[model samples]
Target: MFIQIAIYGLLIALFPLAIVWASKDSNKYRKLIAVTLFLTFDLIIFGAFTRLTDSGLGCPDWPGCYGQANPFQAHNEIKAAEALMPTGPVTVMKAWIEMIHRYLATCVGVLITAQMIIAWWRRSSLRHSPWLATTLFVLVLIQGAFGKWTVTMKLQPIIVTIHLLLALTLLSLLVWAWMRESPPLVVSVQAWLRRLLPIVFLVLLAQIALGGWVSTNYAALACHDYPSCNGEVIPDLDFEHAYVLWRELGKTASGDYLPHSALVTIQWVHRSFAWIVFLSLGLTAFLCRKHEVLRANSNAIIAVLLMQFLSGVATVYFSWPLAIAVLHNAGAALLVLLLSMLNYRARAST
Candidate 1:
């Protein structure tokens, strides 16, 4: 089963490898990084879709569906499981969704492995250190382990949230590496703005973690209103039970079913902290717009922030539609990618 899965992953990876080989761009290494980054972004989105659809346990196992390479081979077992519990996690459609996500993830792993091999082979000619490529390869391996734990651990909230955050972290690192392939920016910025860039990036990461917590806990619908939770300016919340990080999904540390108030607390905190990130990024964009070198990037930051904010609100008001929820997830990844580039440019600038 493991060998079949690996071969399947290699087959999926060949499509992108072929693209890199046939590209008109002279710098194939940079192109490969860019393509991997794009696919990684798509993988994150599909992952959100998987979670939002409640397909995380669709296959009820790791790497393969029902210990088989593909859903088609395990159709009978999946059908039996569905018949046993019609509303349970394992359905034919969901097993397919879960497996497809794994396949894409495997393809990403192969791409990164290829990247590491090439980086070492041409280390002397490359502008950036080959260590970054190697580091990315290592991180992807760790991410895969967490992916396994996410399933084997029964989708524990903490484990699943960490999975989401690690994906964003990988995206951020890939963005930084990709930016290294380009010429450094030649503009100078105010001292305060230069220092503020990293601070805001850290704040953004904290907000993304909070967002992940909200999703993993299935708390998105806890508050049905925008700018106010549950129709109150400050809703009654249960912070005590809200943050027991090691507890099972929908349960307290003592293994009791979690309260609605705890879910409300989770959603409230995520939405409130988002305001802080929104203002910080908005201020950063306002500061950056004055510099000609950073104007375009600054504009992108503002646009994504607005989209992210609106989608988040829509997710609540619209009752967490699949498209808006996935858009919210994609927006968070975009913020990580854009902010990574901004920080690299800040450090690279005079």
Candidate 2:
């Protein structure tokens, strides 16, 4: 079973390997960074899918499905569980979803390993710091550990939220890495704007954490409508239940079913924070427009922000369609990447 899984992992990694090898450009390292960044982006989206589909506990085990390497090898266990509770977490489809997510994650790890090897091999010739690559390698390892804990710990909201945040952090780092290798042409901006970028980045990171909390806590459907939740501007909210951190999902610290009001509060806060994030991105884009190289990147940021805003609204208005939800997640990641690239280019050019 381990051998089969290893082969599957290698097969999944082939595309990224081919991308790095077949590029005719002399800057193979840059190509490697780009490929890794792209794969990481896809990994984030699939991770979101895995969460949204409620497959986090599909296997109900860590690092492997039912102590076997893949879902196929664990068919008997999965079937037995399904027979015991037909509509429960351990269904055949979910097992596939969870395993596929694992496979993709393994492929990403392989790519990162390749990146670290290349960075070490060509450390002297590389213009950008190899330390970034080393950091990325360490991050991927940590992220993988968190992924395991997310399952082993039984989808504890805090653990799951941290897992999501780590993926975002990895995305940010890869974006930074890609930018460092083949930096965009930078035009000077006000010194104050330079100072503000880090603040904006930090704020965005916080907002992402909030979003992850909302998602992992299953608060997206907490409020069934927009502009008003359940026809009230500020519906009754049980902050105590909502804010309890160390409890199982869908239950309060006291083991009671979490009050509906608590879920509403979580969703409401996440929705409200979206406005702040949009405004921040808007201001950053406006500040960026002054630089020619940054203009296009600024436009991209604005477009993604707009899409994210629409998706957020639509997810509420259209009953939380899965496609829109996933796109919203992808939009968040793209926003992070664009901002990271802009910041890196600005720094390198200066």
Q: What's the lDDT for all of these models?
A: 0.92, 0.86
Write the residue-wise lDDT of candidate 1 on 181-241 in tens digits: 9767798877788899999999999998898889999999999998888789899989999
Candidate 1, TM-score vs. the true structure?
Answer: 0.98
In model 2, the runs with Cα more than 4 Å from the true position are 1-7
Candidate 2 local distance difference test against the native: 0.86
In the range 1-350, model 2's lDDT, one tens digit per residue, is 54666678789899878877898978888888788888889989998998888888999987789999888889999999999999888999999999899888888888888888888888888886678888889998999889888888889898898888889889988888777677456466677787788788888888888888889888898888887887888888778788788988888889889888888899998888888889997899888888888889999999999999899989998988999999999998888898888787667565
TM for candidate 2 is 0.96
Task: Compute each candidate's TM-score over C-alphas.
Answer: 0.98, 0.96
> Among these predicted structures, which one has the highest lDDT?
1
Off by over 4 Å in 1: none
- Itemize residue pairs with steric clashes in candidate 1: none
